[model samples]
Target: VFVCKKFLKKDGRKVRKAAKNEIMILKLVSHPNILQLIDTFETRKEYFIVQELATGGDVFDWILDQGNYTERDASNVIRQVLEAVAYLHSLNIVHRNLKLENLMYYTENNHNKVVLRDFYLSRFENGPITEPCGTPEYLAPEVVARHRYGRPVDCWAVGVIMYILLSGNPPFYDETEEENTDLHNRIIFCRIVAGDFEFDSPYWDDISPAAKELVCRLMEVDQMLRITAQDALYHEWIAGNGASEKNLKDGVCAQFEKNFAKAKWRVCIHSCSVNVRLNEVGNNSSRGILEEKPDEDQGLNVLLARNTTQQRYGPLKLFPSSVPAHCHSACPRRDPSTLPHFLSLDYTQMFKVACSTPFLLLICTSL
Candidate 1:
């Protein structure tokens, strides 16, 4: 897609390095589960990054519509994600941001297969990354603390995704901004640092012990102690040798419906701040965040804009909108932590998510 270079020009050095790093890394890797960067274009005003399109909606939306899934289904999905991560770590490439939104189906007809996309925050692990990038909910403890980190952070995010896939809820969350802000901080200090979480009853009662154990090991607070993606692939749950557990499809589906109701409301404040400006920005430019003109593909209305943002901003805002560096544009950078954490989703609020059309537009311009 066409990308504006306004923001990249502002933070020339680091943003360029990050973008180049992502491009180089993506170019080297070829996996069914990882996105392929087909081509690129550079012009005076914009740069175009051409990636394979994912026609089926995101995993979360797919699951919600499917109503429910089985452990086999979760295992199949996680296995693909883990295999992709294992390949990246073997090359010392770390995908710091692995979330539900980043995983998508390759085609509308194939919901069973998923490919991980959006490599904007990825880096090679020659040295530890200390930039504090990635979404808060999936961030590793060391990352949240601003400590040097490596490939294990990706493993931690996998654990979070696995937890949600199994039980249909996040391991750690709060209902309000005050509570979430407080919880977010505590996660950095105590909960995450200490590797603390529980498999509370009912929701997880039917889940296999093997599944829970795998998550516990992967989400270990001590990076040194955490399970690597390669090792996790051999785990009984993922390996498919674990004893059969009760059917969780009905329960999991019920929970997803419940969470989907709250999911839109619980979008990280940081993402919204970066996303909400897309509508205004799109209107201002003929080919802005969302392309008003119809594309050749009739199935997908808007181009899939992809990004994962930290809940708070500092030096990191330099790469706002998470588009490739060449596609950067002007936007007001602000700390959204001061605003209300939760926005209750309703019909009126439909405009909020819809207006932010390029699901990947990470810019939060002050409009």
Candidate 2:
């Protein structure tokens, strides 16, 4: 295996950091579909990442020899590819560069297996990333546009891969050099619309509906609505399960719900604060009572109150009236004994407080 390391210059800090991060992410990821990183080293000029060599070479070479891969071959390759992607995304990593050339085939015990290779264009999910990289044909709309993108870019590339694998052609084309660049630019900005491609061939007739659905969903211009890698893992075609079995397993569903609950809680708290501020603008406001404009000392007190309340009652929903009561009741004038008891009350008790005080029970829910 040959490794490239010309990305370590002082001006290449970003590239170096990205390489290091890719190595770190690769080390943490283990899957049957991923090519293993055997070893790594660094010279002053570059970093070397040694990966297992695929004796059968890249998918592009294989396709060239065969002219076009059969549907079964495409399905087999795509299944492995998606499995690798699913595993990477589970670890919050995105393989931003995905194409036939990046897929390698190796023989193990005389059995052929496909593995995903290349990580120079990969990224994590911690923050915004704006590096323009990846081959032109597989570049996502957002990636081509030089916009901050996350894991969804990987999904778009997956769609492109699927298109090439099944149809033996890319979804977009240009007759002129200028038009080719313009088409790439348009793809980057998500200006290309779906249903623009004609697929009247008999080959498309045998393609499964699930596979087509997944491709369309993954290639969606709207990043927010794009199928996440995790969700795609459970997709009907990829999973080989019917629509009814497409739902996540019970345990997985529970974990998903838990994460959603936490996110919803944060949103609820933020919205509550905004609503409180808006309500404070009107007369007969409870916002003032909630200590909306808290001083330093009051801020500390409010933190203590929230901590104590959470410890005792879990997450307490601060209704309009409940907010003021919770904030004011924690004041020095209130009895210390009552404060401890109130803090110990559960979310149900907090809900009761909101219900009893109609003013506090606005549009807010326990979210």
Candidate 3:
């Protein structure tokens, strides 16, 4: 449990509002790598957020205890952190205050899992965010410039975290406080370019090139060019062949299916071969309206169509060439009652609909 405003602020109203936002965001997000928010409460003087206690403590403390972590250990931790970030971005949330001090570890049934804690600086995508926050060491250039930013700022912090995990020190540092402040200013101005920073330590010698590439991409100054969370998931280091190929294939297939299921449809047509039924028109009239029953063989196809397009057409196919060309031409002009009973029309006039529309083309493209 962490309480706000014991030493930081004196106002209880502000603390309560902040705590409420934190709870709302936490309650909406659920990921294996993110720390679970248990509950929240308010007191006369302070507000408190109850979270799952991390037995392994903060990553900073854990690293300090080990003196330094091996590349394998660092990679495992970083991968989990990226997974958490991916989940956050999926919900359009950005963990703007990410740092080693905020990462926690837990042991359940003798198995360990990293958990991301702290959300004081988190923000919804494009949300009104001001007040330059987060530690200086992990702050992005844009952030230091006090410019408005989105989730990519979190990727910059992830880069800093990666550097710290791999080298046991930040990529940029100075011998004195004054020099450090100067370097920080240079970083904010984009003068201290990331590409110019080289890793010369013995620890980096054994590190894979893919890991280095990913870190560099994540730390890019241009947020537009920075690797997105989804793209990072497909990076060479993260999607390495260590995992079973079958599992990866199945996972990709499942994701495709999930995306396909959400598409909308504009049209559906069905045809049937059953004997046509007719209804009498009037007391003196013998003409009848024709209707055909749906066929069972088309079950799987119908289900697939439904899954692919929100609009469903049953049993019908476009007029076959077997029908005379004249009949095909005249069919469009015929009345519904006189037209072929086997044919059912359920299709959009346009071949392709706009992406914003609820149509089959968008769904097919998504799949």
Whole-model Cα lDDT per candidate? Answer: 0.61, 0.50, 0.50
TM-score: which candidate is best? 1
Candidate 1 lDDT:
0.61
lDDT of 1 at 165: 84
Q: TM-score for every candidate vs. truth?
A: 0.69, 0.56, 0.57
Task: Identify the runs in model 2 with alpha carbons over 4 angstroms from their true place.
Answer: 1-11, 64-69, 108-111, 145-147, 177-206, 241-367
User: Which sections of candidate 3 miss by over 4 Å?
Assistant: 1-14, 60-69, 108-111, 127-130, 177-196, 241-367
In model 1, the Cα lDDT at residue 7 comes to 21
Stronger candidate by TM-score (2 vs 3): 3
Q: How do the residues 1-367 of candidate 2 rate in per-residue lDDT, one tens digit apiece?
A: 2222223433345446655866787687788888777555555654445455444555644544443344456666777787788888877888777866567777523225888876755667788765544544565655544457788878887887876666555565432434233232333223232324444354355556776787788788778899887787777766665222222123322322332121211111211121112112212232231113332211110111222122111111122221322211111122235545344444455444433442112211222
- Give per-residue CA lDDT, model 1, range 80-189, as digits (tens): 99999999898889988788767877777888789898776787888867556665567787765546789999999999999988888777654343434333333333
| Model with the higher lDDT, candidate 1 or 2 | 1
RMSD of each: 14.8, 25.9, 30.7
| Local error of candidate 1 at residue 191 (angstroms) | 2.3
lDDT of model 3, residue 264: 18
Clashing pairs in model 2, backbone N/Cα/C closer than 3 A: 5-46, 5-47, 141-188, 321-360
- In model 1, the Cα lDDT at residue 320 comes to 39
Q: What's the distance in Å from true for residue 175, model 2?
A: 3.2
Q: Which candidate has the highest lDDT of all?
A: 1
Per-residue accuracy of model 3 over 16-113 as CA lDDT, tens digit each: 45456676798898888987765554445434444554445555445444433455666678788889998999899987778765677774232248
